[model samples]
Target: MARTASLSGFPEWLPQERVVEQHVLDTLRRVFELHGFGSIETRAVETVGQLLRKGEIDKEVYGLSRLQDDDDSAAKSDPNALALHFDLTVPFARYVVENAGYLAFPFRRYQMQKVWRGERPQEGRAREFTQADIDVVGDGELPFRYDVEIVLVIAEALSALPIPEFRLRVNNRKLSEGFYRGIGLEDTAGVLRSIDKLEKIGAEKVAELLRTELGATQEQAEAALKLATIQTTDTSFVEQVRALGVEHPLLEEGLTELEQVVAAASSRAPGKVVADLSIARGLDYYTGTVVETVLVGHEQLGSICSGGRYESLASKGSKTFPGVGLSIGVTRLVSRILSQEFATASRSVPTAVLVTLNDEDSWSAAQDVAAQLRARGISTEVAAKADKFGKQIKFADRRGIPFVWFTDAEGAHQVKDIRSGEQVAADPAVWTPAEEDLRPQVIARVAAEV
Candidate 1:
């Protein structure tokens, strides 16, 4: 108890900063609900076996253990048998399988929750963070159309947020894996893991890894890199990949699928989406379309939103629930907004008007005045002490409260605009601030700068 310290990866926001965060969460929820996605919340911890079902994230999983369990009992139960979930999708997949018998087919759910990871933290990547995710699952066969629709849903969601302009770079695992196969390479997964590091480790090093680790020949590595470089805002990427002279049945199928996604998304979201060949998504289960979004000028922040299609993410008996999902890195996005001043709350606190106390004797009357304003849906706060008029005004100013209410000797109320120093007589029952002044509004810095 004597030791006090701070954790590096856990992020906490200040009041004004939280205003922006809450607005982002609200905006995401509103848009998801409008799209007919039902809200769901899952438990924080999942069985360790469930967490490691995918296998690639073993190092990042934080195992849980109980402190008071007897040694013998603890030994019988796997020491690291339970752990916090690393992502929403895994836990959700398990949930669907467990509840499939009672749930409807083509179930659409949106989940906003905190997920924990024990990975090294950096800008935009944290040990603990909030993710806003949406997924559509189907009983037997999930339409490929959901893959296209998922990105469009994300594009619409991002358009409504206060973040900078962004581009959703999409690719399909089948497209990449099929291409690798057509090129006579058996280690498609290894080649993919190598190419996924294109941005991180650069082409030369990645080429070396492909040749050394995957035993890919010189021509195969070059061809893989060539495919990775073929990016287009339209469906032209289909021709670009076809022109590679590598032919396989899976390759053709993947090309047709990707073309349809890019075409459908282009007609809907226009320039917001592109068929970027480099997006491998790293995860092994992404069977179809994969997406990764980058803020136009802030690519260093990495993917602010990402997810993909998993053909067998959830299953029960002979039935498999295929799904497509996307997650918005809420903490990562909001942190950049606050750090770069990309957006800001109009006020530090929710209270828009501070009702000044005329005197200690008028406390009851002051409380009544605040009650009336609040009843009318206005954010009002009553002063705790009857300080000097000048000091009370300063109190309102310090908290960015736009208006200050003062009562005359006879209890006649007057409201003053702290910003403009304009005072006007007003009725406590009917008076309201401007529509925009009722609650804190998050303003984008680019617009504010203008």
Candidate 2:
């Protein structure tokens, strides 16, 4: 017999779990809008060529085809085959190019949507997940200050979420590449790719790859490892790099630019952003600042947010669009929150009060009461059955609805706080639950502990 089972990478949450996810998405949206970011959602499917523009993510792209079309026929008919977008950045670049005639320059936008990747699924990684992204795109020559602003905006967004304290690890690709060249390594991009695997393949393995694959000597590999290990919470990292005795004009420029970002971030959001020289974002387009954020004490989950500046990712007919962006891994964040029980919703449903039916004939009266409560901006639900007072109360209790409303022979109404068994006279037309109890609330478990 055929059996049914859930696909491993596609996650589905229970009602309360979904409540927490919604609260997170709402919080991110509120913060993005508060910072004057307009919202736009790009198409879910992009041409396979468009998705592979960056060249590194070809393996992760999920190609699409009509069920009726065979491979040879489809390839001949449609030269530009479609595929689900692997990341929001590429699609946004395409969007900027396609609509350049209409949009204002230096456009700021926030996008929250699901993305697919045909990759192995791990604890915090999923094949189908949601990412919340914010980007500032310029017509040409985007200022260095916007890079710092991107860090500030992301710091604020992360701070507002109900998660453990986080550290935004900042780095400059110019610094890394220039440092490699200063150390007599000709292949800076090759060196970066090897160093990017330092975390996964261990220091010793990475050293071997550098020497064997990139034709680097033992000293060059050691120096690269040293560069990656240099991390500081303040601008002192600049002096530390100066002490390294490697000098290049690009290195000096990157150091100055990174110092400015770290200084601004420290003054605005102290201790939130750190200068970690080792953060080499593997993407080829990240020409300037790169960042990866990890939750405190949960380092195993990997970076929950990451992005950088792409100086020339979006270009249209001789005009270059330099953009800086940050993306929050929504699914990974929600998964960590749920798996660790870091936060929970007050109730599964939004109903704050259940209007109980006293008898079979009183159903209409309860409905009226519920209607009045709902009209007044209160989340109220009428009981499904007029079986017994105990049964009606039980129904509300099962749903975690705090209040149970009842009517008397004289048409007087009283609502009971099921938790405390406190019944008080109420006017359905004007009565309201306590502000805190009005709707489903997302409560941080840590706050309750405190």
Candidate 3:
């Protein structure tokens, strides 16, 4: 019974669909908390300057203005001009800076909230969606181990959800920039922007862009393409890059760091992480490791999760806060889950038992039974009308309520499992439904099918 979306990019789920989404959110929260990431929420709106300062997402930002305000009140050039935040990272960086005094060093936090964009809606793309982000920001200096940790944590979180197999394609910005520089490509960022499209476009197209747009020679462009194509699940990528004969001090440093990440992940989360050098992220802020995740067979849907290390994203006058993080596109995942029937809720409603009224005069008795059942921690509701027992059972069945309660004329109580038609005398004070029946179950469709 989900309603069609009135607006193209905004998604609205029915009660049952929402239950599945809630299960995803709850599972993510539990895993994140178990890893020691505290939850926090940032404001939905940030200044235009703030939103645009970190990433090249100005075109995606939705400006904020009150109806009563003048047309010129929300100027993009104005530092105070307000717009909805496009992602959690920028606002979180700002938050860390403003509250640096109150926050402990290397603050680990997770935020799940709606973010807005002005993209053309398509499968896995939307104007507004919920994102779940986990970040660990440090004071002045963040260790490289966190970069590796972020991948493992994300792997664990995604594994816990009822989703298909995914691979975290990871790369290091330093490694990319260093190799590009070693090959005499001065416009490292420009080359990265082109390489980021290697998946969408082909290798030839990306190399052509590198030469035409960045003024690189055919040899340099080919080298860049070769580097981008080097991908492996372990540290073998290090030798592959070295075979290209590219050498720079920064390049060596990047190789070491990236090798460390891949080496750690090979043991901790084998087959889950890959050294994908083409993952440029196309953002100017990501200074070190970057990651992009894709479901095994759904690469066309794009990355369901992405983030990286930002060494200079947040800074006070004297100190800088470097952080590593990843964000899960919760809405996009849920959309695919629902569309593909990946999982479903057992019931649309939470009521476990429906207390039926035997007659118009038995309404008070039904209420008493419902209250007693509720007091015992059962989700029980009284029937709205004194309909026939058949009609009452139909109502409960429609809502997926498994049990129905009946009060006899002699004050005896009995409960019937609508699913099984098994009726048994019971006491409202002590009767308890099976633990699994007390709440709606989020059953994985794959497992159910198996």
Q: Give one digit per residue, the lDDT tens place, for model 1 in 12-114.
A: 8877888999989998998899999999999999887777777488778776766775564453346347788999999999999999888898999999999
TM-score of 2: 0.95
All models: lDDT?
0.88, 0.89, 0.91
Which is the winner by lDDT between candidate 1 and candidate 3? 3
Tens digits of lDDT, candidate 2, 1-450: 011117977888888888989998999999899998999999999887777667487778777877777574565235398889989999999999999889997999999999999888876888899999999999988998999999999999888888888999999999998999999998988888898888889999999999999999999999999999999989999989988899999999899999999999999999899999889988898999999999989989999999999988898878899999999999999999988888988888998999988778888888889889999899988887887899989999999999999899899999999999999999998899999899888889753221
Q: List RMSD in Å for every model shown.
A: 3.1, 2.9, 1.8
TM-score of each: 0.94, 0.95, 0.97
Candidate 3, residue 317: the lDDT equals: 82
Number of clashes found in candidate 1 = 0
User: What TM-score does model 3 achieve against the real structure?
Assistant: 0.97
Q: What is the clash count of model 2?
A: 0
